[model samples]
Target: MAGNSDPLTPRAKIAVTAGKAVAAASRAAGRGSGSVIGGRVALKLDPDLLARLAQNLDVILVSATNGKTTTTRLIAEALGAAGPVVSNALGANMPAGITSALAGGSDAKYAVIEVDEKYLAGVARDTAPKCIALLNLSRDQLDRAAETRMLAENWREGLAGSKAVVIANADDPLVVWAASSSPNVIWVAAGQMWKDDAWSCPSCGGVMQRPGDDWFCGECGFRRPTPSWALSGDHVLDPHGSAWPIHLQLPGRANKANAASSAAVVAVFGVPPQVALERMYQVQAVAGRYDVVQFMQRDLRLLLAKNPAGWLETFSLIDPPPTPVILSVNARGADGTDTSWLWDVDYTRLTGHPIFVVGDRKLDLAVRLEVANQHFQVCENVDQAVQLAPPGRIEVIANYTAFQDLRRRVGN
Candidate 1:
């Protein structure tokens, strides 16, 4: 753990103090969030504060379209066995949030940063990280990040100039193409379950096909590279073909894949395989992603499925044990104003399951559920809906603001 005081120059100290004061005022007014306003103030006062925070630090930056926050938590927890880690694990993933977390932990030698997919290039360029973990690239924040291909292009150019060792997912065609040209790289065969985004090759604009566990473009020679670190079932495989079992308190293969990616980076510093897995197993929940809550005389397993891709992963891991599921959606600014992406999500898998539709977008979700012929009930009151569910550990899948609201309402 880092100490109380941060090492800053007189000018930097003034800026950081002013930022803290702004943050305090914002919180007192109940107008802004943690680290968001403070970091903005700090950066406004000193534009180069991020670079200053990066000085002489062993930085490990994690960026992805889907699993950046959870994966960064896995990385930080795994690294916590050695020493303190500085990271924005609370989902404040922008440059401001990154700067705020870094500024506070100024003395910590190790930092596991969660960089936004679009900001990876700029953050990596400024931080000069020792290793950069590149996860799958897909359509996200469509209003802000228009296209996935453009994001991949920016990262491709960013990785080209970076001095860091790139630890990339070999199975993602977009990731493979973006990181293939890097001078130093470690490819991990973290499975790419979502193939909608990779139907077209990024390099030669050719059609791509997935045959067996590998994918290749017909026109160009672009293909899924041979991974040095691979995940097979519940075990992570080493280069020498050794298998080690991994059991996480967190559910889903997505998390297991995340654990493998974190383990790969920890190995760069010579951490034992079992030791890394042990540290990752300690992560039970991240920002209410997979936390089981006792609320309104019912136990609920909260699954934060924000998008179609995330929903796909959650549906795959969901246990069909006759337990009811609370399906909530909200089209807030953070959850994306355009809820039309709901159509792209294949809700067919959720058919024949007990579901309670809630949230501001309940009508929209209920319509989609009915269209899919899935049995569901709409409840304006979530607590009463939970009471109607069978007495057991039920699953709750909620979107951005809905999930956070449920967390506050249930836990409080």
Candidate 2:
């Protein structure tokens, strides 16, 4: 069990057992991964079940707008050097899903949990994690989540009294403001791809001054902190000026940045930078984000980019011009009910490629593409899009629900 020495209370055991059974039923019924439902049932039985399950484990809470899932996976791999690790590897990052993950990995000594940006505070309070990783915060699920500054304030208030060591991105002003109240913080210069939402200071609402790689509020003197670790091009520089080349199975500079952040977080657990990175190098994909599947006689590389910030990073990772790209979008609850976020993306970058748009929100995306003067064909689904694409490999970038649907349909 999670606590071989401490052992769970009888009530907690009953709740966990019941939750597992229901989750199994959910999966058997093809309702989806029953993490949320199962966890909800368990929490209803015991209001404090999450805390009870996480009581004895060394917890690390990872929360961000874009990279939390990938970072959580990397952290879990790095922590494996110490002992078994539990995490919401499937991207089910709510209270119920987190509870389910903990209950399932009863024997895990460490929990590296990916939390939704909105739910981080409550999860932090319950788990009392030894470390919290605060990645960049940008506009995501705008209708569902509060504005960027409001969320930052919420984060600041929530972390004000915590004793956990916070690993924060020094490049994101919003994240810096949010983690400012934490007693202990390790700043990492993980680059931010999107800067639209953070133009104003969270402290004094003054326009921020960006003088190349650094940002400061001219009105309040708020500024980016000096990072103890920094990601420079393909290398990570430690505080001592020693730079380590980051070699990873994962593609893109974003993953390299994530590895740098992971290395810093695991260092608190007594894992050296080299060792942590070595373990992280073993992770090639997270929840099928970068998986390539042979579907309909053609290779389709799956990439998940839910918001503008994510889209900006994804554009850099896709195959260069004329590779043929499939863009899928969905405005379901998980993907946010607002399709207006599409306007924020710079779709003109796909000018030289054959673009095929599909998903429940295909028309919404098509309209946006037309405005950008980018030519695209609206398709029924992934298979149809794949059938029409030019011969050879094709890349597919999708939002939340669309990606999940395609992942299930393609058996990736």
Candidate 3:
């Protein structure tokens, strides 16, 4: 905000200032994250606070069950070439978090927001973003607290009435269905690593056919739209079949798929592919999503997952599992309270690798792993599990609260 000279109305400026003060006070008190309360204060003072702050900026709204944070960060980096990008990359995705972020970066010219699946429509209504990116629709039961099908419907309905152009993944059935109603949708065949959640067509309850990477409903004729942009090996493929090599700071085909979606997104603003791809390769981590935390002389790669779809992506990152892993789980509100999604994941892939289960829900995972005929050792704490890990680099795969707690423990 060194030279951000955009002026806000007097009342609106007052509201944003007050909100920031509240946020600082909340942080000083260590009451909680303070993201929610700060925005709550501002909105209570002026219900249209976010609208005022967003009046002059061109905003991009990113929503998805799994990759919202990472995708948002990538887009923010890509757009930073243009100007200061306001976003809640490290805060909450609800109304309050969005409010606080917008109020803080009030003078920014471009806003790249990460919105929770449930509050996407509400936030969009407040911000009136110029471009909307729907990554995929699914979440742990506690977030939106709605089933994936219903969430997709909500997104479709909300997007239909919005004026923003939509960039959607054509691979995920739910995403394709949800963004279908939007007037201007740019479909990208971003590969979906987890297909179990999208087994049936949301449109006609038809069994979809995955003859290859393409899927279609034989019964209702619903199918993945041909993507104008897609991934080809380690490069992004144009509709003309020209492949542009893209190397990212993040690993896995999933991140490449994310890059593909980000590519299409920035293109909506006439941002060149080189600018977007170059900016993306510099982003190594999004908050704690793919961070390496050091504790007790051991460096652990932190991978966070909240649901089965997330677990699928996480497991892919540890291909040919090297050493025993520190698997953590906690049934807290942030982690969705319900641990049933654990059973849905194909943990049998982890049959050969020894897993040191930790966290509040360790016993529950222990039982599930045993049922799958896998072997594991239960540790009392994350540190103890780390000590007992096989002599090599270890991965810390945890849910919401557990992941945060471990990161905090290591001074992250």
Best by TM-score: 2
Q: Higher-lDDT candidate among 1 and 3?
A: 1
The lDDT per prediction is 0.84, 0.92, 0.83
RMSD (CA, angstroms), candidate 2 = 1.5
Off by over 4 Å in 2: 1-4
CA shift of 110, model 3, Å: 0.8
**Model 1 stretches astray by more than 4 angstroms:** 1-7, 29-33
Residue pairs clashing in model 3 are: none
**Winner by lDDT:** 2
Question: In candidate 2, which residue pairs get closer than 3 Å at backbone N, Cα or C atoms, i.e. clash?
Answer: 2-106
* TM-score of candidate 1 relative to the true fold: 0.95
lDDT of 3 by residue, 125-176 (tens): 8788899998887657644389888889888888876899898999899999
74-96: candidate 2 lDDT, tens digit per residue: 99999899888988998889999
User: Which stretches in model 3 have alpha-carbon errors above 4 Å?
Assistant: 1-9, 142-144
Query: For residues 334-395, what per-residue lDDT tens digits would candidate 1 score against the true structure?
Result: 88877877877898887757788899999998888889888888998678679778767888
Cα lDDT for residue 57, model 2? 91
Write the candidate numbers in order of decreasing lDDT.
2, 1, 3
